[model samples]
Target: FFWDRGGEALFAVNHLARRIIEAKTPKETEKSNNPKDTLAQEGLGILIDINGFQKKHIENIHAIAYMMAERARYFKSNIEIDPMPAFERRIVHEFLSDVADLKTESQGEGLSRRVVIKYIGAI
Candidate 1:
């Protein structure tokens, strides 16, 4: 079920099947407000999921992984990335898990938490 708003307090909850509409109102609302962000989000979403949020998130993960892989190998030292949510930190850890010379760890607490990639020097 989805809510269709015509005005303040003038909305109806209607059932919708994914086959009926490729994009849901929630998906549209989620990316609304900022045109630049919406475009980027939609472009990325087309590559992955219809929501776009997941695709953009995955892109962020890939970007962080690329940086970590390069820095951990070249500098042979630990690198700290910007603070991210727990799920995002998990993505980084999982993405780098198979990297022979790279390892990921989470540090800090609450909203200040972030991931730290360290060069483990080949197993």
Candidate 2:
């Protein structure tokens, strides 16, 4: 179905899809040794990206991470990003992994978890 509500709608659909998949998955399959079953249990195997919205959203995330990293470096202080999902936090961490003068850490609990960019002395 076509959704005209933009990114918010896409996110909602994806979230609902994950929940539905989780609800339908068999409890036995969740513990199975098979890779396919494990993948299903993880809920990372299913994503419905409409018209590359996910890709564009990821790029926006990268841009935000870069901006935040620069702010941390310029201010020589730690910068806390708003809470985001694990996958998004992972993107921020990996995107900034190679910066010599900065470090990324995940903080907070559960849904409030977010990435913090810490300014370290330039190498």
Candidate 3:
């Protein structure tokens, strides 16, 4: 699905679509022979976006993570980010994975889960 704008509403719709798709998907042994079904099963299903909003959102997330890392480094202490979805948290972790002086971790539960940038000292 596509939209002219994407924010909380778009996010909610995308999330709902994902949940519906997952609910309707068949089990491994009961997989369909159709090529389309195969593609969906392989995670190549329809994409929901709003004029490249997802890409822009990812960039924003990366920017925030970078800033947080800088803050942690400067303060020589751990910094906790505001809660975000698992997908977003993963982005933060992966983006900072190669930074030798920082460690990223997820804390809290469910919707409260967020990334924490821990200062591990310069290498």
Candidate 4:
């Protein structure tokens, strides 16, 4: 699907998944050692570039996740919903790409946050 017509979003998300693994690999390079923090920042910049892909460019999943979680669950019920789209998720993706769990197919509110956490970790 991506090859035929998919734009940068697909590729970005795919790169994102792999980057997550890359983030973790460095941790293993030396149990006591850590990956260059800047690497995470670089990865984050790449992820931030993803934001350039507005909802108009990507899948419906993001929108659906927002509506179902924020509207139906969070604000509607005051139940705290999933608090998905976890800020930690995106920041981690961007800044702490290594820590990402590879659950990139975030459903409800999880997408925004996971993606955000990854981004912040990188930048």
Query: Backbone clash tally for model 2?
Result: 0
Write down the lDDT that model 1 would get.
Answer: 0.65
lDDT tens string, model 2, 8-74?
6777777888888877665653487767666666655566787887888789899999999999988
Residue 79's C-alpha lDDT in candidate 1? 92
Residue lDDT tens for model 1, 1-123: 111231212111111232223453336546667665555445332222333445565687879778777987899999999887665787788888888888889999998999999888877
Backbone clashes under 3 angstroms, per model: 0, 0, 0, 33
Q: Provide C-alpha RMSD values for all models, in order.
A: 14.0, 3.8, 3.9, 11.1
Assess the local accuracy of residue 94 in candidate 3 as a C-alpha lDDT between 0 and 100.
90
lDDT of each: 0.65, 0.84, 0.85, 0.38
Give lDDT: candidate 2, residue 65.
99
Candidate 1: deviation at residue 120, Å? Answer: 1.3
lDDT of 3 by residue, 10-107 (tens): 77777889878877876567799876577557765444777788789889999999999999999999999999988789889999999999999999
* TM-scores vs. true structure, each candidate: 0.57, 0.66, 0.68, 0.29
lDDT comparison, 3 vs 4, better candidate: 3
How many backbone overlaps does candidate 1 show?
A: 0
Count of backbone collisions within predicted model 3: 0
3-121: candidate 4 lDDT, tens digit per residue = 33445455557578667756664443344433555454344333342444433433344443344333422233311223343433343223322332221223344243223111112
